[model samples]
Target: MKNVVITGTSRGIGLELVKLFAEEDFNILALSRNAEPVSSIELDNVSAFSFDLGTEVDLKKASDFVENEWNGKVDILIHNAGAFLNKPFQETALEEFRRIYEVNVFGLIGLTQQLMPFMDSSSHIVSISSMGGVQGSMKFAGLSAYSSSKAAIITLTELLAEEYKESGPVFNVLALGAVQTEMLAEAFPGLEAPLSAAEMASYIKNFSLTGSKFYNGKLLQVSNSTP
Candidate 1:
């Protein structure tokens, strides 16, 4: 009977999460820039919605629809749609940085704020971050745009957890090391191997429902192999 609303459901972790959770009978509200199959004979519990999070107009519409459709109660809100611009700090353009933050930070905050009223005592807010967000990693070059934004997101989640404590919702971040998704291919193309998206999605599912009891507010890290 959990009501779940997930943004950025077109591809990568977001898409995998949508399909995986819908199969489990959670009432799903899926929003993405790309079209998702709606009214499926197979997935009767899914209501697929599409909108670009980088723009304000699209986000307003998405918020209105989701708020009305979900009817002022969301047990879980997963902010999984984000982007990475893999240019060195020197080469990264201001516009590219803006685009990265547009999706990673601004859009995410916008959607969360719009849905905040619906978050009740038991609501859970989960954001996907990265190990890059962790303190000064192994000196990887040309990831300034991504790492910085993710680091900020991690802090944002923590602060949000404190800010909304009265509502009893748990806002947290997951600094997953690396997973096989389109984002990975784009961020670091030609990698020999990476963790499968479905496998990671499964871990997220299990963790959210159970491990969360012991793991709230901690930057839970999960991978095929630990870094």
Candidate 2:
């Protein structure tokens, strides 16, 4: 079975992705800040652990698990963890802005670096971004820190794909629109999203499995709505 590692598995799209992968019988490492939700499922093919992208110790733990348990082989690595902040740019403190980048950008960089050694050419690295991050896309007020950090990952994905073009492990990013996730609900209360978390997760799962063959260092605008 292919080994997959997913971040932000505690809820929403991340949680749905874990279930989809488990149903497909893939060996999965589900990392989230709260491991209880995933751990309670008790799937033999799934392992749940508390992970913080900003914490070096957590990163080491994930690296060690891949090294010792999966034998240093990861077929898919999904960077889905994100930190959301809905505040006016002027009111957002430096520390708060930095925290957003820490999780959405720096944390992703650190984790990808840590696990890249275990991934081969056949491996796929999918980073989840937002529509707001795309250039000339619809912009939302009070998401300056969040959206800008997401944009960083899109460029980073393209760069990694070029740098490792000969070595393999395809890199791609998905810039998503609004989905009915807790994060979305919290960020924009009372606004109903056109798609559900499970719906989006299914698309992401399918893409992660096959999109690498057709695309690399590319950004797919996976948004049907203008959020």
Task: Give candidate 2's whole-model lDDT.
Answer: 0.96
* TM-score of each model, paired residue for residue: 0.90, 0.99
Kindly report which residue pairs in candidate 1 clash with one another.
none
- Which parts of model 2 are misplaced by more than 4 Å? none
Residue 34 of model 2, lDDT score? 99
Candidate 1 lDDT (Cα, whole model)? 0.76
Candidate 1 per-residue lDDT, tens place, 132-198, comes to: 7776554357878877888888889878877767666787788887787777777768763357888
The window of 10 residues in a row where model 1 has the poorest summed lDDT is: 33-42
lDDT (Cα atoms) of all candidates against the true structure? 0.76, 0.96
Model 2, span 126-210: residue lDDT tens = 9999999999998889999999999999999999999999998999999999999999997789999999999999999999999
How badly does each model clash, as a count of residue pairs? 0, 1
